[model samples]
Target chain A: MDKFTVHTGTGAPLRASNVDTDQIIPAEYLKRITRHGFEDGLFSAWRKDENFVLNKPEHQGVSVLVAGPDFGTGSSREHAVWALMDYGFKVVISSRFADIFRGNSGKQGLLTAVVDQSAVEQLWKIIEEAPETPVTVDLAEQIITAAGFTTKFEVDSYVRWRLMEGLDDIGLTLKHVDEIEAFEAKRPSFKPKTV
Target chain B: MGRTLAQKVWDDHVVRRAEGEPDLLYIDLHLTHEVTSPQAFDGLRAAGRSVRRTDLTIATEDHNVPTTDIDKPIADPISRAQIDALRVNTAEFGIENYELGNKEQGIVHIIAPQSGLTQPGMTIVCGDSHTSTHGAFGSIGMGIGTSEVEHVLATQTLPLNPFKTMAITVNGKLPAGVTSKDLILAIIAEIGTGGGQGYILEYRGEAIRALSMEGRMTMCNMSIEAGARAGMIAPDETTYEYVRGREHAPTGADWDAAVAYWKTLPSDADAVFDKEVIIDATKLSPFVTWGTNPGQGAPLSATVPSPDDFTDEVDKVATEKALAYMDLTAGMPIRDIKIDTVFIGSCTNGRIEDLRAAAEVLKGKKIADGMRMMVVPGSVRVRLEAMAEGLDKVFAEAGAEWREAGCSMCLGMNPDKLSPGERSASTSNRNFEGRQGPGGRTHLVSPAVAAATAIRGTLSSPADLVGSN
Candidate 1:
């Protein structure tokens, strides 16, 4: 995981709700065992249309996404997050996010910032009107600032710390191996084993 | 205060806990499939780590497996490579894998319970969203991402925050022909897609108790479509009987002891939940989705709703977009929407019982002319069981193709897929845009409704087939 503190980038306004994982990275691109090179698959279906948001000239190379409510609402494929990051998105601002998608974002260091619908609307307005205006997402301050507008965002504190520090989750959990073994020792005898 | 079933299960799995920090919960089972796990295994190799508990983890090849022509090599090179990666990774890590052509090979969720690996009071995790299908046994089964899959493989545990519990109480007996799929679809329609966010749902009340284990699994399977990470039903004789003599189920004294512990796993009578929703199951009819999302549905008897019907801006916009993508008109009868294909398989409704129900509806009746219907079982086991019951002949004689098991056409990973602009009445979970294939449209339906729709060339329910049969 790469450390994330304050990232400044242009924004793309995806004015659609329930932008599910299937739309983000279709299942066709999931055949690759490796994670990189998914940039082409990001919104592959919608990108074909000349009028879609991401295909606009001004929104090219944008790293901040101001999206509708309930973004990433379906599927647990982390490929959704990878595709966003691979396509140059560092921060996704939405009114709400699916639980599993949000959790996956924390692990992968793609910042999912939760704000009220009003904030989302304002951000969309700012980004759509001036796509090149730089937006800064500050994890330390828990706020997003862009084009003279600022709004506080919500994120799990522990996740915030890990993101800022670039900590590996497996390493953090491995620190308590002894406690895990202790629990396993007390587990009931009837629990089925795979082998 | 008494704790809800979710809280009780969460408490039991805690390995470590502290203020301001998520609890370290022990995982009893980890299910994996080919699609989302290859990268996780690659990460472990890069990090010089090995699987911590192979005894608690199992893998299967489903998402990319070709359902037909079982003996031939996979026609898609990329798909074959992914499956090969899983075969190699599982062998290297010493994890048990049921690969393609294996007798036990199937969708991960379908095989887990059928083998008696899923039990009450356990915590199960998988990389697929439909892991909630296992929660029918009073367990906490959640879907995770590739990173979490790697974490679980390395440690057999997850750090998690507590979840809020919501009681979805469905009272009254479900009317005839109103299956659990209809009941759950109706629930999701009422709640909207995001209604269950940040909550674990517990299905309770008389209506839930009346459902068979397969029905309960169908209900829990789609909890994700409503934004719930997991959904559960308390274990009872229904659950026990389903698990009693499967391959991995406890035997002799172990079985007795397991049942004793399971008896204590249900929520106490006075247990309180963070939220409660009550529904009269008697009012539900055969349900189907008319839009891209599962929540965008209504009873089969209703008409396509106009965007003007929604006051919420997001919902209104979504409805308009859905109507356009689905090529549907407002005020059009749902039953009048025509379909080109009918897919009958997935983790949702691919069990033997599901096959039987559909076969019963198709018996002695042919699907409408030019209608393409495929009956792909969830697993080889399910296919074998259906064959033994002579359901395959029924499906074949009715003009539906009886195919091998795997997640065929559930998603677009395999060769079995819907063509662009094609429409299907599918028994799969999602009805998302391009879910079956690019530019493909899917309407989620139960197996029975799928069969009936195949015969009618439209979104019809089993009741419409009564006189025809």
Candidate 2:
């Protein structure tokens, strides 16, 4: 995972709400075993339209996604996060996000910033009005800033710390290997085992 | 304070707890399928870590396998590669895998519970969201991403934060012709998609307890649809009866011990929940989704709601978009809406009981001309059970295609898919746009409703077929 202290990038506004994981990277794109090269599959269904927001020339390569509420609302596919990061989105701003999607985002180092619906509306307006406007997300400060716009976003503090530190969670968990084994040893005999 | 069922299960699994750090919770069972496991396996290998507890892990080939042509090689190289990847990964890792053509092979959620590997008071995690299906057994079942999957594979535990509890108490009995699918759809509609966010929902009260284990699983399976962390029901005689003699279920003395522990897994009467919602299930009828999201639903007796009916600007905009995408007209009666297909299979409603419900509705009858219906069981075991009950003959005789098990036409990762602009009354979880296929419009319904819709060539419930004969 990459450290995400402060990221400055242009934003693209996805006006639609409840933009689910299926819409982010459809099930068809999940067939690939390799993690990279999902840039083509990001929003594959919506990108077909010439008028879709991301398809607009000015929004191309934008790294910040200012989307509607209830973004990433379905499926537990980390491929959604992979697709977003693959397509150059470093941060996603929404009024709300599904639990699994938010967890997946944190693990992959893609910052999911939850702002107020009022703030979301403002960000959407700013990005839609001027696609080139740069938005800055500061994980250390937990704030997002743009031209004449600024707002503090909420994130799990532990996740925020891990993100800024670029800590590998598996490595962190392994430090407690003895505790895990100790707990396992006490598990009941009747517990089902695949073997 | 009396601990709720979720807190009890969660506390029982806590391997380590600290002040600032999240609880390191031991995982009792880890279920994996093809699409999500590949990346996790790669990550484990990249980290030079070995699976800590292969005995607690299981894999299945479901997402990408075709329901047809089981005897032939998979035609799609990409799909085949993914399945092959699972086979290789599980073999190298020494995890138990039920591959395609194996009688034990099926949708991960379905096979787990049917095999009795999903038991009360366990912490179950899967790479798939519908892993909440196991929560029906009074367990703490949750869906995790690939990163977490790898973490569990290497450590048999997860670092997790505490979750708030919501008691969704459904009082009274579900009226006749209203199934658990309808009850859950109604619950989601009442709560909205994001209403249960950050909370573990426990279905309580008389109506929930009355449901069979399969019915409980059906309700729990859609917890993700409501944006909940998981959904659970307190284990009772119904739960024990379902698990009693399964292949993996404990025998004799072990069973006695298990049942005694399970008896202690429900919430105490004095328990105080973070939130509470009381619903009267007696009023619920056959429910269906008219729009894209699972929450955008209504009773089958209602008409399509106009966007203007929504007071919130966000909901209004979303409703308009859903109306446009679904190609549905406002004020049209839901039952009057025609369907191009009727699909009855998925982790949601592919169980043998679900098959029997649809079969009962289709017996000695035929689907309408120009209408297409497919009955794919949840697992090969479910298929065999349905066949033994002569449900296959009933579906075949009704002109509906009886197919093999897998998650066919649910996520459309398989060959069974809806064509562009096609509409379906599907007994699946999501009604999200393009969920079945690109430009495919799905109206989520119960199995009985799906069968009746196929016969009438419209969105009709089983009760609508009454007196017609």
Judged by DockQ, which candidate is best? Answer: 1
lDDT of 1 by residue, B305-343 (tens): 999999999899999999999999999999999999999
Q: In candidate 2, what are the lDDT values of residues A62-95, reduced to their tens digit?
A: 9999888889988999999999999999999999
lDDT of 1 by residue, A155-192 (tens): 99999999999999999999999999999999999999
Which RMSD values do the candidates have, in order? 0.8, 0.8
Tell me the TM-score of chain B in each candidate: 0.99, 0.99
Candidate 2 local lDDT, B1-469, one digit each (tens): 7999999999999999988788999999999999998999999998789999999999999889999989899999999999999999999999989999999999999999999999899999999999999999999999999999999999999999989999999999999999999999999999989988999999999999999999999999999899997999999999999999998999989999999999998999899999999999888999999999999999999999999998999999999999999999999999899999999999999998999999999999999999999999999999999989999999999999999889989996889999999999999999998999988999999999999999999999988998885
TM-score of each: 0.99, 0.99
Model 2 residue B79 CA deviation in Å: 0.2
Q: What is the CA-based DockQ of model 2?
A: 0.86
- Residue B203 C-alpha lDDT in model 2: 96
True contacts kept of each: 0.85, 0.80
Q: In model 2, what lDDT does residue A47 have?
A: 91
Please give the TM-score that candidate 1 achieves against the real structure: 0.99
